[model samples]
Target: MDEFAALTERNRQLSKAMMQSVFELACDLSGLGPFPEQAAKARGTAPVNARLMQIQQLIEQLRADLQGLRGPYLMQQLQGLGVDQHSRALQLHIGSGPYVLDGWINLDVFPAQLSTNVLWGLPFVDGQCRYVFLSHLLEHLFYPTDAMALLQDIHRILEPGGVVRIVVPDIAQCIAAYQDGDTGFFRDRVEHWGAGDGQATRLEHFLAYAGAGPDPAWLFEAHKFGYDQETLIRALQRAGFKTILPSTYMASTHSALRVDEHSQIASAKHGDRHYSLFIEAIKE
Candidate 1:
């Protein structure tokens, strides 16, 4: 791997380790079973306690180091892309997984040749980008605070009157389906997308459809939170976006803001269209 890729991998490893350590600390403090035996053995020892504190301090330092690396790393990526910060015509697709547009910079967190992690912040001067697009990307973030921060970042990078199109799974539609006794719609369409083999039980299906799963990777891919129209509008307004309006698949108020049909359809199964909510907001 290249230097940037190697650093990114190392950062990811450190983040995972930090999370595990935090969980263990919680378990230890709570007197919960399944705490590491090593931790249990070292619990009452002064030297071990001092070492644990040192390790935590080291982790905090490493996290700060990683944060410092992000800006320069993203600037390098932009340089490689031949992107100019002064260019007013720059458009971006954030969290753009395998969705390439001819005239836009497509970015994602995954390790890909074309994708870059956008969580660091947009690699542009304020008001440099004319348009931004992200579809079904917000729900993966585990915190609403992070989501709002990202939206505000996007707003900061966008030019005056620049539009951002967002699409997310409609939580309202999911609730309606559940209430209307169309559980199969949620089960078959959202959870599993294959011929019925009767593999999962009803409870398992419901949990999976609701974005709860046992797999560790699900923490990254599964929906952490859901939003209805009003909630999304409020978030946009909070992010300094005015003129927020509802939209539909492949449709927008301006022709220039049209959704990429290839990307949109490729992201969904046959009957999954109705489950998505599309909205556009302008930075004014």
Candidate 2:
């Protein structure tokens, strides 16, 4: 037990030292001058990126330690992410990952993933979301019209400076892939689902009244309509967002692409042909 405690302390110290070294090196590269002592009083803390990275590293090290110990490791990791707050009262949105890193509220009209149903209607929230994040959610809706209305509702719910961040698979990119004749094998994956305006229920949607079904053009089994970057950007502008970040090639932008190793591996294996567009819009 004493040896285990000593190893844990050693790992933590190593992580902290690595972070401090990286920060100082960054400061040097930027010609920031030894991270001025005066800056400490003026700025009050470290930059957000450095802190977030440190937290992530610490989590990784702790997870490794838990595995070495062999029991309750996953639970410890979940506790680190605050996953203990799961509740039936909350409506979970579909495709929501375990953590809400960017401070988005887990909400949906239907409880699918990690959301509590329709947070917009809740009395105390007062439409003050920091940002609304949707992961491949919009394409599943049948009524693009009602989906636009939902965005407007989101705008209404947000505080003045708050923004919405949406990420959806781009249909145009897939069509471009098909037209380019990349690979006959890949062409088989092109689905042609149609969008119809009705209360469509599918097993994945839990047979609940989903606003619309998948568009039949690109995805036959279950995709409604695929969106190109232009269509999505224009739609958000019409929905009353004051500022929409310019859409660019996801691979090119620093902030646009999440550069995690897992994302890189997945993209490489699957030929990232699907279009994923992200939008950041401020409420007017």
Using TM-score as the measure, the top candidate is: 1
The local distance difference test score of model 1 is 0.72
lDDT string, candidate 2, 194-252, tens digits: 22433322322221112233222223124455667787878788778868775433332
lDDT for model 2: 0.48
* TM-score result, candidate 1: 0.80
Q: What is the C-alpha RMSD of each candidate to the true structure, in Å?
A: 4.2, 23.9
TM accuracy, model 2: 0.45
**Candidate 2 displacement at residue 259 in angstroms:** 10
Q: How do the predictions measure up, each by TM-score? A: 0.80, 0.45
lDDT of 1 by residue, 1-284 (tens): 89998998897777666666677676675685534446657785445456678988997898799788777777777778887756786778877777677777888876543445556666779998888988878877654677888899999999898999988877777677666767566455644354246565555544554556534523555666677899899999999987998988778777766755747432454264556788999988
Output the lDDT of residue 97, model 1.
74
